[model samples]
Target: MLLRTLSCLCLLSGVCLAAQAQEEKKAAIKEVTVFLKGAELRSESKVKLPEGESEIVFTNVAGNINEKSLNVGADNGAVVQSATFRNNYLKDNGPTPRAKQIEDSIIYLSDKRNLLQNEITAIDEQINVIRNNRKVSTEEKGISTEELKKLLSLVRTDMKNLLDEKTKTNDSIMKLNTRINLLANQLREENNRDDDPAGQITVKFYCKKATTSNIVIKYVVPTAGWIPSYDLRVPHINAPVQLAYKAHVYQNSGVDWNKVKLTLSAGNPSEGAQAPKLNPWHLGFYRHTPVSYSQPVYNQQTSDYTNTAQAGAIIGNVLDNNGEPIINSVVQAIQGGIVKNGTVSDFDGNYILKPLSPGRYDLKTSYVGYKENITTGVIVNSDKHTAVNIRLQPTDHRLEEVVVRDYKVPLIDKYSTGTGRTITSDEIDAMPTRNTRSVASTAPGVYDGLNIGGARGDGTMYIVDGIQVYGARGINPSQGSNAYDNTMGNYVATENRGVNTTFDIELPYTIPGDGKQINVAVKSAELLASYRYYAVPKMDKDAFLQAQITGWEELDLLPAQTNIFYEGTYVGQGYIDVRNVKDTMNLSLGRDKKIVVTRDRDFTMRSVKTIGSNMKESFVYKINVRNTRSEDIELVLTDQIPVSYYKSINVDDVEYQEAEYNKDSGELLWTLNVEPYKTSTRTFGFTVKYPKRSNINL
Candidate 1:
């Protein structure tokens, strides 16, 4: 009897242990928070936990997860003991249904293309056979001349028909090839998920009693991110500019986000939140040659970039004054004296500044023993190449000179797109290392000084001369506060989380695992803007309409690509560079064709005279602004005089009429209120006295 009782207890313990074993439960993704460089996915499931120790395994999770970011929780008196994540290599996590369909379609198109190619081959063979018959007829023995003529005619007709059919078949094949290429491209985009095994998160929990408990799990994935973009629309010069903030969200996490609630955050989890430590800087002896002080000559050639709206590039060759290539020249695209993008010239002096948003930037090129040349107002268009040639002069060695050129706003802009979060000058100035790459790396999505995850190769079609081509924010948040305000827009809930700004989308979205961009509207607002017509007659005779908005900081904006719309017509693409914003933000609304501007040198006032050992050159520039529109307009005319960089060169007799003059930069700004059908004329003159042997470029 005692032996039987012990056997019964052993059986009961075995049953209890079996009941506490791990229970696999599939978790449904409930919500996702997409950051600038990563995303956090939250999933939940309900499972019954037996008394005492129990385990729950959540399967089919994101494979590209950051293991250290896993968090698990349970309800109904269940205490989480431990949790671990491991990749399920045995399970086959194949492509989604949509992706599979795309693959199948690609296969079908490829087969069709092969069949068309075979048809072309058969057509060629038929043409060859007809030619062979023609040759045989010509060599036939004792055939009548009329019979031979008829046979030749028949052969010629047959050959012509076969050739026509071949041409048609070739056309069909080309079309088929085009279709196949598109499908292949689509398949590639849809197949961008990581090849790692599916993830399984197992959580061990302790329960006081047997109960049904709800379990939730959350983790972060590095393969998902979003980029901000905008659309600035202006109804007219007097109306406000409508700002539409949007986000281009993308993910390749090996899991489809179907009907998942999304919250886009301006924070980047890839860059840790810990404050960076500063290292000591040790000074070393200067053994390298210094940069030259010679005068630089800049020439820019531009082409219209009206293709797909994507990031563009600036490509050119860096050469010396003697037309020799300057290898290892450092070329930078700068705005507000901050280097936004930079590249080093190759051995052949060829350099390509890529992935630049559509906007105007100053191109600065410098090399050892060569003077630095800065080309102001170089425009970059979207998906187009803009060429800018740099010619640096050799050092004169005798003269120690410093030249400061006045800043000029570009009147005409080319098309382009934008990316990269803006790092304010203040933030960079406070950093221990002020390196351009180091400072830009702190911005979201910038890794190792490169903007990653923003490249798109969708195999878009473009015809050029009948040829086809394919081309590619800091938020302040409270401490763990979840308070949000949804009064901004309908579909999105704007939340001012501490240290970050998040937009919680109200409606659920079906975002695929593909890494294609799906634009999501974040916020929209109509702010009061000041309008003025600006003209730099020295560079461009056309007048550009600019709008200035105050308190743009409240918009929580980052640097992004902007589409400009003026008077309900699409003007072009522009970039909102909020890195250097101050009291007001200015946006160019494109040029106004109705307003004409002209700058002419007054030869009558131009004179050169010798005074002792120095020569004095007098010059006068006249600017004319004609307003043809029916309404009165305000115009800002800008011009500049050369600033003396050396003590021997003196600028005297400066005369600017009703304009703001900056002595440091030698820039003259004139604001005029011109009425309709009226022409306004303004003149600014200056005299430069320099050494007789020295030449001044005016």
Candidate 2:
């Protein structure tokens, strides 16, 4: 009985061992497959699993996949006994179902958090800009309280959304941790199973979670206002294309309209895409269409105002070198032969002139402390917009009058090259002088007492009627000074020094008296060669002889029409005639008709003389004259016997009760009368001495 029982126990034990072996064989992995979306799997063909835990790699599988979808099953109709999903397979191929859901939630919340952060930063910067703008004056700043409040509300909403996303992300992380721990515990228990003794017939399952947050940055460009323009083309493709339009860019978000930046792009969607593109279009070009949030056009029918013919004017800004506005600047417009005046610049250095007739105009600008500006040919095309920039140079306000006179005399005070003096016409009228020569002495650096540099002070060339009188021959002895003597001679003489002589001939009267006019020219420095012979007197007798012979003789004999040439050029012409002659016991006397050549300062006198052949005759007569020094002369009478010729001699009211003739030479002499810028003439007679005849002659 014991032997039979032992045989049955052994058979039952063997059967149990065989069943466990079969279960172990069924637990071994047979196949592996990975499903992936939006990702690539490593192998597309069928894959067989190894006897132990095996791994398969699925590259870049979608994060949404779950570990529960990955299963291990028997190839035949046997039950999946002790089935296991390897940890390596799960980690490399897919994620747990619950873990994947949590991960997805975290990713979505993280994206929301990032978006809120960006919005917050942008709102903070905008708020700061608004606050800074508020500090400006009411007139200078631009912005409204309503706009600022709206921006603040938007920022607050973005902050709330960010906080909500953070809370959601933390919850997702906690739930995913708890689910991963449970899955790990379940896998360990299955691996430790021991139903039969062939390696415990165990199966292990594992799942890994791979999660990532992706931020999809999408940019939706803000819509812009529409602008209309016309494109015109020529028949030839190579001809230039023309587009005509006007538009404006304006700030919409509480920013400065002038300071906003703008860009433009244009293309025809159906064509070959050759179109003009303008960037920063606000500054460069304009279309006829209006833009969003922009002001209405002042005059819509006039594109650039060329044809509208409205009254146009210039609005200008005047700025200093430092770009500061100049106040109280005088603005004037020269238009239609009339000057219209205006006043100070406004606070922004702006000046507006309205309703100006459309034509060329000159804008004259002046300021108290700046140089004047003249802008010319400013054409105001009926309602057109034109801009002119003016930059002023600094000047002293006190020097306004002197700066206005642009006349500059070169080298007036400079001491470099030449030496001369300026005698204004004002000085000529104010100074005390008897003649132009004397007036010249009042000029600085001039000497008239004596000649210097071998030239007489009076010898300095007299420029009369634009003619040089230096070497003029046959000049009247009465019109000008002898040049060697310090005094110019007088034509009329009187007893008392201070008495005005009625018989005195005015120097310039000689020209008009002879049916001509006298116009005096300027006087300048004279040459030395002309007056060298008269430099020294030989003796008093020689001097007296020269005075009587050449000086008085020439003054009485020439006519005004006689041409006086200087180096072969006809400068002037005139004549002088001596008419009446008288004979005395010691001298002969004559009255002369004098004529002067103004171009050369020449004068001459002419007279007729006759002698009788009837009887013996002789005579000696006394003559007296005055000198240039205002002294009287007494001359001696010497030869005899001509009582028959006494009727030809006459003295008509001779005024010299104080010795008028020189006694030695028996000639009449008188002080020469000099007048300013004029020529003087006088009529006087002198006695000539003669010897008595011994007997009667034919």
On lDDT, the leading prediction is 1
Residue-level lDDT of model 2, residues 279-363, one tens digit each, is: 8735657569743423233321111122234566678888776665553344556664344323335435687654455778888
Candidate 1 stretches greater than 4 Å from native: 1-23, 103-194, 276-488
Which number leads on TM-score? 1
How do all models score by TM-score?
0.61, 0.15
Tens-place lDDT per residue, model 1, 133-239, is: 88887898999999998998898788888888888888887887777676666555444443446788888889889988888899888667776766666655566
Score candidate 1 by lDDT.
0.66
Candidate 2, residue 14: the lDDT equals 100
Worst 10 residues of 2 by lDDT: 530-539
- Angstrom error of the Cα, residue 7, model 1: value is 30
TM-score of 1: 0.61
